[model samples]
Target: MFYQFPEDFYWGGASSALQTEGSDSSRGKTIFDVFYNLAPNRFFDGVGPNKLADFYHRYKEDISLYKAVGHNSHRTSISWARLIPDGDGDVDQEAVVYYHEVIDEFKRQGVTLIMNLMHFDMPAALQAKGGFENREVVDAYVRYAKICFELFGDKVKLWATFNEPIVTPEGGYLYDFHYPNVVDFKRAVQVSYNMIIAHAAAVKVFHQVVDGGEICTILNITPIYPRSDNPKDVAAARIADLIFVRSFLDPVLLGQWNAELVEFLGEHDLLPVGLPEDKQLIAANRVDFIGLNYYQPRRVKAKEHVPHPESVLLPESFFDYYEMQGRRMNTSRGWEIYPKAIYDMLMTIKNEYGNVKCYIAENGMGIQQEDQFRGADGVIDDTYRIAFYKEHLRYVHQAISEGVNCFGYHIWTPIDNWSMINAYKNRYGVIEFNPQTGERKLKRSGSWFKELVDANGFDD
Candidate 1:
């Protein structure tokens, strides 16, 4: 490989609480159940999150697989329901034992654990009480964060407060893709603000309590590209970027929200409600780094047709999404394949957000292939996935060379894990698992990744 990453460069894989852990009910209810039960058709194949990868039982075996694949670091989330059954009151003893064992086993295997405190798994018990929109939910989240820091702070050095906190407001509240499906911009802004406060509160507690741990927030940043060279389209792209990417990154990293976003919210009368001290909390608890999960770019243009003047207004009412023509796309998930977006995102973080230390925390393609382990060879020739990883990684190398504070690369998952709605609908794993029988098999890409790690680069 021409672009050799730095020595001691971390290479790993990432998974979430609701996606891989199968013991959803072993502790308590979560927002996943609320969404699925409300609208089963929204999920791919109509499968819920109950039957995840069963990592709760098979994690010991899974960590060994991580070693086989040359992963020195592994990222996984702790389930809130598992820790506090109702997301507030008492810590579950069973969950504490299981997670401690998992962390210790990883240490025994010489792998570093990057633990995320929450990953969209709001205990359904809390959602029934208004979820993040309610102030009490923020207090519950702070308590949960405190418990994790106190319990696992010694072993876990890298702590992520929340994984894609903005997605709840964007996908769940404003777009109706998740539970408590309400399409209200005002409510979305309120939820987004609350999540930021919750994150700050968690970070404050982590710093106050956890002595030697570092904390960061994960954002699934989709770089926005203008449809054409038209200046109006360019302005629209900037607005979209301000709304989607900078909305959270600015506050978390720069210690304040973007002025453009604040002004836009003011124009719409959707400015978030915050206590006077909330600003002080956010400003005080700035993160040490950022975890950028870039998969694709968002193509945008100015809205061409204005809605009826008398109609009810929404965010979409002002902007129209204009997908760029002839852009590369991921075939299975139908997501636009824009590897360059990763480089652009890093550049933006460097230029606009003060060049904070960050990493490609989650990036991978989801493939729908059934014959991944169909032969006596027990090997999957996942050439497409290999290509996806290499192309995206090339961009990371380019960004690193250009002075982006890029640290490491963690693919979306290590093994084929289950998703909340789709339930193993797509595969983005280096290691392919027979979800039916719990058989672990390394795909050809897994071997390729191991060589990449061993050689410190891909040789041409």
Candidate 2:
């Protein structure tokens, strides 16, 4: 079978600002910087945000490399901390000029650049004042969004509000892996609620400012699977899906909170403090599309035991993770390699979520220390990466064929970039990056991708 894709389909990759752009152009401090300062050892090799893939200095060359590697479209972020120092302060003229040049470069190379507003990289100045936990920070973020729209909207028609926004509150407040580490359930709820408001406010502002641009949110959607056909396991899976997936999905696409989620939170006395007008604001500003970042599936089961009434509460307090025996796993990242979950997710979107226009924002395998796979000819023989893409793309094609509104497929990244805590431990890129000398080389997967994008499909 000749597995073909739709005409005008977007074919490219996705990345973020702080992950790729090293601290440059008078960039202000970010939450990652603060975290590294507090606990440098937590990150791989003790690498920090200040040290990155150096996209800030090497974007021109890197863009050329991505284009050559067959990227007709790409997704990346505009650093809020870089553009407006402190998140709501003086606009950095140097940052402005730098971003302008970068966007122009993408246009010059005939690549569509989708600029994301935030990717868990909040400005430290705003974060210091409570980050998303503080209502004032929501306004600051909206203002930042407006500035980005007016500045880059002319050249960049595609924009995203946040990339995997759940990680912000989930990591920082619930798990304490991020800066401003706090383990308060109420605080986490408040942070997530504020982000919803912030996203809606930005959507409202974008329509008011930008004339002809499409704005969306990038959500990391992992399909939840029940351990068995038992009702308790199914219930656990449903609630977990509600908490992780629908929490943001409902608000952005349906323009309202999941009713069951709200009632459950209220019953548990865990609802975030909000205003009546907040609902109206959210209801009025739904996104134009969605970018679903699928990496793995989550296997869940009913709580193995009742939580102590006096103990602190968490999402896991109601459910337990189920490790399936003989499940296909990615040893490099410890994630399940279930490509069909992509099809299941898209079907759910079509059946339940109004079938919103969407695309595969990020789907790639991360292998640790890929340099060990390099051949004598200076090429990484990453046949595994190519096989991984083929498997996932087949599912993506199946979903589109069945009318799931999936428009494109973008891998996790175009080149090796820094990940939070992991740094560059797991390389998820078609192109390799040399951190020290800023060198790049096309891997075996890179050559394969160029052909795949050029043809818009591959044979089965």
Candidate 3:
């Protein structure tokens, strides 16, 4: 086989409490539950988070399937609202028991657990108190992280402070897809700054409480591609990369801020206000490792027009999106299918970022109406999904061969689960979670993944 992974490399999938755990009655309300409750019609098919893969109740069976599919590790999340009920105050013993049961079952199945602290499911109680925008919320998050580390650190092999922390500021404050929707760039910068503080403080907590487990932060990096060879277009891509990529990446991995980003935000008068202590806290609390998630590449061109006087300035005010002609795309989600972006990103980390230990935390293909591909033999023959995995994994192996300090490869998920606004409009899992029948059946891609796991690679 031309594509082979290391002997002890992790091979499995990733899931979040918001997407997989079902029946919102047992846990405290998340902002997602509140948003879906307010406007179900805004989501696809009017389905809310109450519709999920039922991992809360069926995690044993789910773990068994994970082992059956030849998994050695799985990255999952612990719900703050589930574990603590509120952001602070009291702890829920019942939720603690449930998580212990789930973690024990994963151990029995010989699957290593990589637990994440937050996955966009902020407790509604905290949201009511200004979420991450307030310094009080940062302290509360550190408390939550300390509890999680002390309670479950013995069993969990690795810890991640936040999964794609940038998405919260981008989706909730910049865009309106998430709850507490506000489009103020100033507030978004504040929220983003506070999250960095929270993450750094959480990393400090993880080290103090946990004995030896390393902590990381997962980032979804979409490589920005310039429209042409012109210096203006290249400069636009650089700005976009600083905003979307470096804003989170630099602080978490390098323990410093990008001076250019600071200058840009200062010029716009959008810099976040913080205390004197935050700079040192962020610099001293760099992560033990990193997790990189990639799905698509973004194309950008130099701005063609100046913003109107009445319009609010945004990151898009500097760069315009360009859809390249003849580029491959995933028609279901309208995402570009440029798998080689993974290799490029890995190389960048090697050359510029000190080659910190990292892994492919997520990479997957989502297609609409997967039932259309179901075969008569009671399996979904998702060859396109298979092709997606093959191409992406090939780049991963190539990067590994070039000595990129990369380890492990986990897909977006093993079973289809609840997505915020989209619900289950697009399926990205190898194991089919049938919402109609409430049963999970292995897709053809699942079997192919098992082969990949067993061989630790693929044949040319």
Candidate 4:
């Protein structure tokens, strides 16, 4: 079988400022580093995002690698602290030069750049002022996004206002996975509401200034399904989906907040205060595109137990995760393998959200293997990775045929980048990196990707 992509189909990879660019540059300190610094071991494996794939110094060589590996496009984010050393006022000249060089170098290699303005990297200075909880922070983001658009708008055509805006509130406020770890539902709702406002502000600036630039919001949209055909289970799945995906999607894409979400929050008295002008501002600037980062689907069902003060609580305390029977799993990261999730996500977008153009902004498998790539004939054979990507692409091809309107596909990362708390424990790169000596090496899957890019499809 041969599944060929369109002529304009994009072949590229993704990296984040916080994840790939080491924090040692004049980028200053982000809230991520500051929070974990307050308590180092609070993160997974006791390491923060400081120890990253030092792309700060190696971007020249890395950009060259991206070109050599057959990339027509690449996605990367700019650290807020890096640009504004104070997070609000003066911009850093040294940081500006570095990023310009990186962006220019990519352009020289004939690669289109998709620049994300913020990717969970809040400047420590901004975090000092209550982060996303403050409306002042929203104003700061609009100014910052404007600066980026004015500076890089000519070269970069695509801009992302925020990456997975809900994840920060969910992980930091609701769940205990991220910093300022709190278990308050009201604060989570507040933070989420403010982030949406911030996103709308950025999009408004993008449309007003940048003549040809398009701004979109990136989301880690997970599809939720019920355990059985039971009515309660099905209803729970719909509510969870609303809270997770549509909560942000509706406001940004459809130019209005989800009425159901507002009604639900109003029932709990969790709605944030906003004026009539604020409502107009949000409804004016709708997104031109979407960036979908799909790795796993969420399988949920109605919760069996009632909430108690002593219970381990989360935002989704009303639902229970029901692992599908006989489902395949990524043993390395323990994520369920559900290829159909991507297809369903595309169809859902088309059916519910007007089939807006989108791209698979991030998709990759993470493993725990390190220093295990020895060659039989001078080549490390990573067949499992090759298979992992192929299976996903097949599904994407199916989506394309079904008129999903996806423009491109980007793997989660180009090189082995850092995770917030996981440190270097997980491997999710086509290009493997050596943490011991800061060496960069392409795995067998990297070569396979080059072939896939050259062919513009997969044949099996």
The number of the candidate with the highest lDDT is: 2
Better-scoring candidate (TM-score), 1 or 3: 3
Model 1: colliding residue pairs: 1-458, 1-459, 29-124, 30-124
Once model 4 is optimally superposed onto the true structure by TM-score, how far is the C-alpha of residue 5 displaced, in angstroms? 0.6
Tell me each candidate's RMSD, in Å, in order.
Answer: 1.6, 1.0, 0.9, 1.6
Q: Candidate 2, residues 245-359: lDDT per residue as tens digits? A: 8899999999999999998788878999998899999999999999999999999999999999988899998899989999998999999899999999889889998999999
Model 2 stretches astray by more than 4 angstroms = none
Clashes of each: 4, 0, 0, 0
| Model 2 poorest ten-residue lDDT run | 16-25
**lDDT (C-alpha) at residue 389 in model 1:** 85
lDDT per residue, candidate 1, 239-358, as tens digits? 888788888998899888888999988998999888999888888999999998987778888899988988656665766887676878777788999888899999999898889999
| Residue range 1-460, candidate 3, lDDT tens digits | 5687999999999999989998567799899888988888889998898888889999999998887777899999999999887888688888889999999999988999999999999999999999999889888999999988888988885999889998998999998889988888899999999999999999988888888889999999778899998999999999999999999999988898899999999999999999998889999999988999999998999999987878877889999999999999999998999999999989888888999999999999989999999999989999999899999989999999999999899998899887889989999999999887889989999999999899999886
Error of 4 at 108 (Å): 0.2
**Lowest-scoring 10 consecutive residues by lDDT in candidate 3?**
17-26
> lDDT for each of the candidates?
0.86, 0.92, 0.90, 0.85
Off by over 4 Å in 4: 309-313, 377-379
TM per candidate comes to 0.96, 0.99, 0.99, 0.97
Whole-model alpha-carbon lDDT for candidate 2: 0.92
